[model samples]
Target: MELEEIRVAVLRIEGTNCEDETVKAFRSLGVYAEAVHLKQFYSDMIKDEEQRSLFDFHCIVFPGGFSAGDYVRAGAIFSARVKSVLKRDLEEFIREGYPVLGICNGFQVLAELGALPGFDEDKPLADKPEMALGINESNRFECRPTFLRHENDGKCVFTKKIEKGKIVMFPVAHAEGRVIFPRGREEDYLERLKENDQIVFRYVDERGNYAGYPWNPNGSIYNIAGICNVKGNVFGLMPHPERVFWRYQHPNWLENPESPGDGRAVFESVIEYLRKF
Candidate 1:
């Protein structure tokens, strides 16, 4: 698809706070991107022209924020509502190689939706979530710049433009962002992700070495910051890429006044991947 022909839907619903920035991230790349409310896809109260279908866009994104007030564990409420209304469509979308991304609260949603660590290629979403983003080991929200080392060996289309081992600063803000695998199966899941080349990013300190505490932030097992589905079509992470799409958005904007931000490559990689279709 040509750049203009590519349409991206940055999905949003009540309490989703980053749609505008997410939309700006893609729009800045010259793609047709917009923030579409989840209700706009299925709510009958919406006008005919306002309603949308999952197939209308080339990519789907679930941006960050406390959806539904995060009253129910993080993204639980939003994910449940999405599955109840559009499970099949979402599954088919991922199976078709359309990109689906969830960031931060959105990451929690995909985990709750059972779409990440997608072990079964035939089953895009497991019967139940295989992992969980539990409360931070700190027991409080950790909101600050994080160094992420891109680890995927070219399987993840979303990070292809990013060189392997490259470290980028993307800010993370969440209380329940710790990625925990099934108890007694943590090493097993990590091994599988490594074996399939599914791991996308790992948290590291400024020196590019895996560290704990504030550096690893949430104390996720293996310092995992992100991962993709079995087919590499769906991805989820806890950091906010859209929050640093421009140099001015960076923490050291005055000193690192580069044209594109550290996070720009995340969007660029996907756009580059879509240009072939």
Candidate 2:
């Protein structure tokens, strides 16, 4: 597909407040993008002209924000609605190698939908969640700048433009961002992620060394902050990349006036991948 031909859907529902920024990020890259309400996909309340099908877009992004007010364990409510209404469509979308990205709360939704750490290639969507983005280790909502080290071996479409081992700063804001696997299987799951090169980003300190506490933020397993599915078409991260698309958006912009923001490469890489499909 040509660059201009690629269409992106920044999917959202009630309380998903980050849709606008996500739409802007793609639009800034000169691609066709829109903030698509989930109701348009399966709800009968919307007008016929406003209704939309999932197949119309090349990329789908589950932007950040407390969906359904996070009243029932973060993304549980939103994920259930999607599964109940558009399960087949979502399964087909992933199976067809279309790109899917989830940021912050969206990451929780993917976990709730069993789309991340996608262990079974034959079954694109798991019947139950294999992982969880539980509450922060600090037991409070964390909002601050974080450093991430790219760890994928050029497999994740979202990080192709980023060099391995390079540390980039991306701000994180979430209450339930810690990544955890099934009980007694943490080590086993970590091995699978490393073996498949599914691990995309890991928390790191300013010196580029893996550390603890504030450095690791939510205390994700193995300091992991982001990951991709086995097929590399789906990715989920806890940070808000759309919030820092430009250098000025960085917290230390004045100190590094000439450097391009790290988040831009993420969007550019995905768009570049779609152009080839």
**How good is model 2 by TM-score?**
0.98
Residues 51-95 of candidate 2: C-alpha lDDT, one tens digit per residue: 999999999999999999998899999999999988999999999
Cα-based lDDT for every prediction: 0.92, 0.93
Residue lDDT tens for model 1, 126-172: 98989999999999899999999999999888999999989999999
Report how far residue 275 has shifted in candidate 2, in Å.
0.4
Model 1 worst lDDT window (10 residues): 251-260
Q: CA RMSD for every model?
A: 0.9, 0.9
TM-scores of the candidates in the order shown: 0.98, 0.98
lDDT of 1: 0.92
- Measured by lDDT, the strongest candidate is 2
